[model samples]
Target: MYFILFLVCAALTIIGSLFRLNNLKEIKQPQGNFIGQISLDFEEIIVRTSVKEQIKIRDIKNIDINIRSIKGQYDGYSTSKFYYENGLSNGTENFIIMVLNNGIIKKYQFEYIPEISFLLNQKLIEHYYKIGIMDYLNCVDILGLDKREDWEKFKKLRT
Candidate 1:
């Protein structure tokens, strides 16, 4: 029937639209001021902002790095405040590094820089190994980190 064919076409169009919207990559634009910096030492991950805070490698619960769009709604108002105060526009991708230590979540947001993001991810992985993968996996759940491949490999090796 024509009605059935029309309904199928309409469903396909809606699905296609949703797929395209989900897959659309956010554009990278110059962002606001850099708020914090992260560096790794022998036993600590030092975060320097207005004040320096050091978190021991053994105390870290989770480390996550992701590209976040400024346009999206954020639970942390500080992120939005910094973005708008620095005169940044919507659709700017921010390189967000979140570290969970002792039940506190510290977020450091910076302008989208691929090299910096890559280095941070590498440093976290390096530090995770120092504490032993088993211990790290115990502290960090499979869903806690964005890098699921590493989690899968470790879980496989453990089994």
Candidate 2:
């Protein structure tokens, strides 16, 4: 009975080791976003989903937003942003990309991933505040958010 128990424990240990190895392999080599992959690295962040949706951006780009009309779909404007890497496409089919200094936030809609959106928004608010109004507005201007209230709200959110 002791021998049988020892064999069972050994088998379990081997199985556990195999499982750990599989997990490590996954971490080392990401399989892409179609399987819903979200990777954050030191220099870049990538978000992808199966439905031909993806967003990849470098850390240096900082926060940016773009508003444009969706073709034959919405009566309102849709945001077009983000720089895709590795041949990934940020098609206008409900995919939105928002890039920032530390990372990028891309999704079908801000409501789709509230947690990620909140985190990115917080980061943008902090970054804008840290750089002061003139510089921040310069960024906002580039993104076409020229309204004074938009800038004011951004500053207010810092508190």
Best by lDDT: 1
Assess candidate 2 and give its TM-score to the true structure: 0.26
Q: Tell me the tens digit of each residue's lDDT in model 1 across 117-137.
A: 334454445456545522555
- Candidate 2 yields a Cα-based lDDT of 0.41
Against the true structure, candidate 1 has what lDDT? Answer: 0.52
Clash pairs of candidate 2?
Answer: 62-100
Question: What ranges in model 1 sit over 4 Å off?
Answer: 1-28, 68-101, 116-126, 129-159
**Model 1 residue pairs with clashes:** none
Query: Where does candidate 2 stray beyond 4 Å?
Result: 1-63, 67-73, 76-120, 123-125, 128-159
Tens-digit lDDT track of model 2 for 64-159: 333232223222212112211222212223333455445544343312232243234445434544544224654454334567887787657546
10 residues in a row with least lDDT, candidate 1: 80-89
